[model samples]
Target: MKNSVKYAVTGALAGAANGFFGAGGGLFLVPLLAAWTKLEERKAFATSVAVILPLSAVSAIVYWFRGGLDFMTAWPYLIGGAIGGIIAGRVFQKVNMLWLRRVFGLLILYGGVRAVLLL
Candidate 1:
């Protein structure tokens, strides 16, 4: 498939994942971008962030229209997330990709475990 088609399909899937899950498009996107497009790991990660930001905004707007979002409860997290994002962005280029991958994997594993156990 052409790169444009591949990217479109990947973006569709990521958007679906974000819309359905309220976030986590990057969880699907980062791996798909790295594997399917043969993008470098760090570039894949950065690209996922860029793509997800718009996907998330669209999703959030949809959720708000559907009365699924509570801005009052979300403000604290938004504030903290903004600060953390700034810090992460500033230091992102300096981080070791291997360790970043390890931490990402661990977080996914933890989330999976918690999800399964919660059920």
Candidate 2:
């Protein structure tokens, strides 16, 4: 398939996942980008973040329109997330990709376990 097609498919899947899950586009995007587009690990990670930002914003807007969002409750996390994002963006280049991948895997494992247990 052409690169445009590959990217469109990937974006569609990521957007679906993000819209349905309220988040997690990056979880799908990172691996898909690495596998389908043959992007390097670090580049895939960065690209996923870029893509997710818009996906998340769109999701949030939809949720807000549906009265599903509570900005009062979300404000604290938004403030903290902004600070965290800034720090992560600054330090991202310094982190080793292998360790980053391992950490990402562990977080996914942890989330999966928690989700299963909750169910």
Best by TM-score: 2
Give the range of the ten consecutive residues with the poorest summed lDDT in model 1.
Answer: 1-10
* Regions more than 4 Å wrong, model 2: none
What's the C-alpha lDDT at position 111 in model 1?
81
Candidate 1 Cα outliers beyond 4 Å, as residue runs? none
Colliding residue pairs in candidate 1: none
lDDT of 1: 0.93
Candidate 2 lDDT, 1-119, residue by residue in tens = 59889889889889998999877888889998999889998999999999999998999999999999999999999999999999998999999998999999999899889999995
Model 2 per-residue lDDT at 29: 90
| Model 1 TM | 0.91
TM-score of 2: 0.92
lDDT of 1 by residue, 15-111 (tens): 9989998777888899999998899999999999999999999999999999999999999999999999999999999999999999999988998
